[model samples]
Structures are given as C-alpha cells and as structure tokens.
Target: KAVICETPLGCFGQTICYDLRFPHLYRKLSQAGAQILVVPAAFTKKTGEAHWHVLNRARAIENGAFVVAPCAVGKVEGGGESYGYSLIINPWGEILADAGSDSGLINANIDLEEVNSARMRIPSLRHDKSFQF
Candidate 1:
C-alpha cells in the first residue's frame, strides 16, 4: 500500500522497515510526486546489521529522492535487539547524517536543488517503459 503525505516543504511518503526492500512501492510513491521518503523502523539486530544502510542509500540513489530512515538501536522489550544507525541520505546517495549506535543527534544542510540536479542528469523516472509478453 502507498500513502503520500503533504507537508509545507512538499509531498513525502512513509514506509516500514520491511517495505524498504520493495522498490516498486517506492517507485510508485515517487511517481506520484513524493520528493522525500521516510522509513521509521525498529530493525532486528540480525537484519539491521546486514542491510540497513545499503538499502536506505540504494533507495535514495535509485529514486533520486531523499531517504530519512531512523532505526532503533537498542534491544526491545521482547528480547529482540535493534541496530541503531539512523540515516539521512541525499538524492545522490550521500549520507548527509548518521546517528551512530549511541543516542545522538545528526544534522545536515539539505538543499532541495540537488534533487533537481540529480534527476536532470539522469532522468530514469521519465524513461521507464514496461513490456510484457
């Protein structure tokens, strides 16, 4: 399912941790005018250790949109653990800020112009063509 939110800045979409693995969902959101994507998750230590950062960065790079993923780092109530590494990735797949294992604040100067620049250079969104046999 897709849910697009309108903020004063622009339109944004949000997804859970598991949803980040699906590209089509993000594609649909971006297609529908989502300039930013939020992934708020309490990823398990097992999975979070392996794929958290890469997935977030990949999503930003592939969609040419900002990805703001905040992952819970500590262990949960049910004996589950969280891998803390909240990230703010830019449209160019650069990590603007990262919250490390400990509780800390991350700040970055985000310029929306960069989104336009990346999309202008590689307009993949406009070039997708679907075909089936």
Candidate 2:
C-alpha cells in the first residue's frame, strides 16, 4: 500500500511491511515527490533478525529519504513472534532512534533539510538509468 500524505513540511509516503522489500516502489514514490517513507510492520522474528534494520537503512540511504519504521512488539494472536526493533532512520542512514524489544515510543527530531543535503551529496536518484536484462 502507498499513502501520499501532504503534511506541513512536504509529501510523505507510507508503505506496509512487505512493501519494504520493494525498492522500486519507494523510488516511484520518491519520483512522485515523497521525502519521508513510513513503514508499519509486523516483521517476523526469523526474517526480521536477519534483515530488518539493514533493509530499512538501505532504503533510506539509497532513496535519500527518511525511513520511519514502527514495528509491532511481542507475541501476536497466532503465537507468531515479531522482531521489535522499531527504528527511525535519517536520509543519511543514521539511526535516530531504536526501540529494542520494548513497548514504548522512539522519538526523533527530523530535519527535512537533511533529505536535500543527502541527495545533494549523492544524487543517485537522478543518476538512475533503466536497462533491459
């Protein structure tokens, strides 16, 4: 799912958990003018342990957009375990906050200007070229 939110700052895009695995989706959202990406996930313990933080950071760094992932903590209805490392990552791949297995909020003072700064430093988005396999 994609959500385009027009906040006081700029356009923010929201994607569901599984959508985080798709980079192209985030790129499309960025091309359509998304500066921040929010991912709400109930990432499984198994996969999350191996890929959660890295994926979220990679997405933010590569797209030059802030990544805010709010993950579900503790056991679910079906006895499924969720990796609760909810994170707030900056455009530069910096971890602003991490909620590690706790039931609480992780706050970060995000500066929208950093998005532009990161993009300016490495303009990968503008450099993308489509090629056929």
Candidate 3:
C-alpha cells in the first residue's frame, strides 16, 4: 500500500529501500496527489551504483514530482558497504543536490510550483489510459 502526508510545502509520499524498483507504486502515489516522493534507503553498494540515480530520476520524471532519496553510506554491520550519494531531484529529473560517497548533509531549494509546471509541460499523467487484453 502507498501512504501520503500533506504538509505546508507539499504532499509527500513515502517509500523505503528497494521500493525504487516498482514504478506502479510511484504512479499510485502521484495519482493520489503526491507532489514529492521520499525514499530513505540503505541500498547495497553494488546495486546502488548500478541503479540508484537512474531509478530516482525516473520516478521523478515519470510522476512529474520531486524525489528526495537519502541513502546510507560506509560499511554495514554484516560486511558489505552501503552506497551513499544521497540525492535531491526535481520534477524534471534534474539533480539538485548529490551528497557524494561520504556521510554528510546536502540541501536544495525546492519550489512546489515546479511540480505544476512540469506536469503541465509533460501532461503524461493525464494521458494514462486503462489497458485491456
């Protein structure tokens, strides 16, 4: 299930690690009026290197919503490493901030109005159609 929280800034939708793989979940959240999607992940270094950035940007682009992903870095308890590179992406899939491989902080100024602008320009969400087979 998808959950959303309404705030003064925007309507945020939450998802944890590994949920990044599923596009339908994001679509559900966006359909429910989510203007921002938050993903807090502890992705393995291997997978994150391969998929993290692209997946985050894809979600934002497809949904016309912002994606804020704060990822875990450094060594894990079990042995492998957690990939860092925390990201703050915009509705147009532009990377606003990226906290490279170390554990630190990164921030960006987000305009909720960009959500409306991006959606207006793309209008893909409004074009969604039911498929019958």
Candidate 4:
C-alpha cells in the first residue's frame, strides 16, 4: 500500500517501530520520492543495543535517504533503561552525530547532495533485490 500522511514539515507515512525491520518498505518509500525518513522510537535496552545503529545506517545507505531517529533515554519505572543511542545517520552509513545514554538534543548539519554521491560511489541500491528463494 502506497500511503502518505502529514508531519510538522509536510506529509509522511507513519510507520511504527517494527516496520524498521523491513528494508523493502524503506526502499519503496525512497523510490516514491522520499528524501528523509523520520523514526521516532522508544526501543527497550535489549533490542536497541543489538541492532539499532546497524539497522539505522543500513536503511539510509540502502535507499540514499537520511534517517533521523530520536530515542527516549534514562531509566523507566520498574527498573528498565531505554536504549539511548539516539542518532542521525547519513546515506553513506556515516553517523552525523549520536547521543548516547543521555537525554539531550543533537543538531546535525546535513547536506542532501551527499546522498546522491554515496549512492553513486557504491550503487548498492540498484544491485540489491537479487533473490534466491
């Protein structure tokens, strides 16, 4: 389903946390002309430590879209620590800035031009999707 909705800036498809596991969804969104994917997440300490950074970078690198994820930090009630590596990743799998285990705002200087260049150098997006099943 091709969907579009609104954000503070404009319209955005409101996909939840589980959707991050599906890279194809991101590809579809990017192919549909999305430049940025905003992921507002509150992942638990266990899962976020395991896959957060890699997945965030992978999706951006794959689709040439900037992935901006702001995550909740600190210990929650009932003795749980939220996984707090809030980050902004570029299309080159490079972390622009990351806030680790602290509650704060991270400002990054992002250039849209880098996305095209990173994609061109590797060209992985065009090479993905080959399947054996």
TM-score each candidate: 0.93, 0.96, 0.97, 0.81
* Backbone clash numbers for all candidates listed: 1, 0, 0, 1
Deviation from native of the Cα of residue 66 in model 1, angstroms: 0.5
Clash-forming residue pairs, model 4: 5-12
**Tens digits of per-residue lDDT for model 2, 1-133:** 5678989977899899999999999988877778999999999889999999999999999989999999998898969889999999999999999999887999999898999899899998999879999
The candidate that wins on TM-score is: 3
Please identify which of the two predictions, 2 or 3, would achieve the higher lDDT against the true structure.
3
The digit string of per-residue lDDT tens for model 1 on 1-133 reads: 7999998877788898889999989888888888889899988888888899889999998888999888888868869889888999999999999998876777777777777888888798888678899
3 versus 4: better TM-score goes to: 3
Each model's lDDT comes to 0.86, 0.91, 0.96, 0.77
Ranking by TM-score: 3, 2, 1, 4
20, model 3: CA deviation in Å? 0.7
Q: Model 2 residue 62 lDDT?
A: 90
Better of 1 and 4 by lDDT: 1
lDDT of 4 by residue, 3-22 (tens): 55545543343455667898
Candidate 2, TM-score vs. the true structure?
Answer: 0.96
lDDT of 3 by residue, 17-111 (tens): 88999998998899899999999999899999999999999999999999999999999987999999999999999999999999999999999
Segments in model 1 whose C-alpha atoms lie over 4 Å from true places: none
**Which residue pairs clash within candidate 1?**
73-84
